[model samples]
Target: MKTTCKSLLLYVLIASVAVNAFDPFTATFVVGVGAALGRWIYEYSQEKCDSKWIAFNATGLETDLERRLFGQHIASRIILKAVTGFMKNDNPKKPLVLSLHGWTGTGKNFVSQMIAENIYKEGMESSFVHVFTSELHFPHPSQLETYKTQLQQWVKGNVTNCAQSMFIFDEMDKMHPGLIDSIKPYLDYYDKLDGVSYRKAIFIFLSNAGGESITQTALDFWSAGRDREEIELRDLEVALSLSVFNNKKSGLWHTSLIDKNLVDFFVPFLPLEHKHVVLCALAEMEAKGLQRNLDVADRVARDLVYFPKPERVFSVKGCKTIDSKLDYYT
Candidate 1:
């Protein structure tokens, strides 16, 4: 808990000086850039020059990931490096593309929110961030053609408005088979397509596909008595790619996105265990302004369901349902 407190305190202090104001709620910015000045200007906005974290805070983001996001060392490292490199580069050859794969409640969405909050002052609410859910946005199969046209237009329009626009696609497994390929042209390496350059945009896909393979690998590592941190990207990247490509249930099944190597990275989120869940519950306790109680956190963690028969090594739903379980105890 002291670590979290220290991180937050240090971040607040640095953020205050970075923007020349402390309060994240009501501070106004004096942006000089013509493009940035027109933005609705959330509580955080500043002239980004060279890689000074841009409008983003590298230290704060790393602290947040380490302090709150438990388990999955591979994920935290991959996300930080990828984002930092992309943001620092002024002339990226192609937009940053990442596909996060894992079981439910494995912190995919949480990390996504973290990225948004660090980049834009308003976070997910920022107009520059556009989120689309497969189940909600494209529900019908008959409208596949129309959805394709609209999706392309939506992406083009948003990126044209802001060079640093972010696009997040959720539940890709639920999306239609051919739907994802609609925007393939935009994700390619092109200086300008119809007059707009997409080299500065970001695309993130979140899905449950390839989760089974990831869990099995983690289980194997555990059975061997090896450290989870030792499991590197090379260990799972190949198997994950093949599994998602052939898995008929996935939205990217046989899609060109994987075939042509359009995806820059395929990040895997391992299933959570008992210790991780306890940490999550404790964090929840802190967030709720309640006293940190290990007893209550343990009780909440024990109450949640686990899987793999009698061994019960992995969380079935990850930490997705931890908030409600914590609420029961508090």
Candidate 2:
């Protein structure tokens, strides 16, 4: 509006200088052009601002994240609740930060993808969704300083540009502790932070750091003749946090995030049972548009390796390889 008004005034001045008096017709034409330009500018600015509001599909996310993630009832439920609250909170003071801890192939990554797919119209391909794997992006220990700088800048730049941005850091167990701490600022609560508010952003960290402790807790419950369903978030919360903080291999060890309690949730993906594996196999078959067969699913489940020779408790790889293992039955 300012630019257009200035240009219009300049045009009238030039016209008046050229012809002792400004032509009313020329002045009217310039004013009309300025009005059009001002409207265009207003529209452009609105579009830019509206681009930050993501089309979050809460209902679809509930179905996909819950259905796809098996053998993790407690974790899935907590995730759904946290996400629902996060989305509904109009003016959040901190980013929604989640630390997913569990065994490999136990649906940590799968759940993350489900969240991304449902929240983003472009699914996993959305530019607003950023994924970083330690193996792929932070492979060198010597580059920890550089990685920290880049990570902070990347997050600040994205969140500043789009408050609804989402970031996923995979294989977080391999990321440096220093690097992990770099994200603490964004997760901390402040009325106004760094001249930019990150209250609407989302950050997810995936790792196997607490898998052993989680599995053991589950196993203890099973041995005590308790139903697997009895295991709850309250049961694992303290253990999971301690494991992540005390384990030397975990990137979060001794981090201020734990002390400040910045992590919104510690969701643990429990080990998958045979029934969960069967469900996974069935889902995979359905994805291929193949008819479901209980016999095939049963065989695939039996063939999967389980731990503790006698008990034969949990699937070694959970449902991680269930899709590929289904081919053997064919």
Candidate 3:
């Protein structure tokens, strides 16, 4: 009844203006256009939390991670299980918090991108997927207090808007220590803070904080003549977390997030070997819609610097410069 009366009043108002503003045909056209514009604005501004916008394809994520992401089998597996399990749950106790630690170009950012692409229809372009770079977003140390307040509000407001929202913090190694603690409340086991449940949200922290420890473990395996793929999460998680906590340079220096067991996983992205770099080059070519050129890919991979003096087992920067390097080679 209320809806019908509203429609009648709206129609009457339009009819009232039909004479002075426009002819009958013109008035109808104007009203139609106005309605369409209003609807378009609403659709454009609001992102729906329906299946159309948010759907997790676990198989797709696993397959892509296996195909597109090279090396670091442990990181890939942990990501798949942790994310898949969390999304599958109807009611989670706390937000899924993952701290991805690795050296540059070893696929920390790449893995994060893959996760977003699988969950959100718009991928990295989705409004619900928020990315904050420590250096770019919160550079000034003197503003630690201000950054904390703003950071808390940002997470709270975004999660309120969409519970399944993904927040990625890039370059966490450079982030001020206490700044992250501001949002610690959101990562806790609480059902809700201020009547808003953050349990469904996702928080990812990327950093080079524990790269040394991870690399050392991989190097040790190589020294023992074991396959790099044989390296497991059990081999690295403990040392990695400890190193990240102790390292003064790492943004997570003695953070309560780790102390209180808030971070669910300290995923270690191992250094990329020569073969992995070659795979990266080939994948880049495929992504660019180019024909698979093994020779070009080989050259591109070989051109990069590798480590450990004579052995040169791992690519120093992994696939970090693969895209531009491919452009130069091809």
TM-score of each: 0.84, 0.82, 0.89
- Total backbone clashes of candidate 2, pairs 3 or more residues apart or in separate chains: 0
- In order of lDDT, best first, we have 3, 1, 2
lDDT of 1: 0.84
The lDDT of each candidate is 0.84, 0.83, 0.89
Worst 10 residues of 3 by lDDT: 1-10
Tens digits of lDDT, candidate 2, 137-211? 899989989988998999989888878888999988887776888878888997557798888989998999999
Q: Kindly indicate the candidate among 2 and 3 with the higher lDDT.
A: 3
- In model 3, what lDDT does residue 305 have? 92
Q: Rank the candidates by TM-score, best first.
A: 3, 1, 2
Per-residue lDDT of model 1, residues 70-179, tens digit only: 99899999999999888888899999999999999999999999888888766787788999998799999999999999999999998887778899999998899878
- The TM-score measured for candidate 3 stands at 0.89
For model 2 the TM-score comes to 0.82
- Please state the error at residue 102 of candidate 1 in Å: 0.3
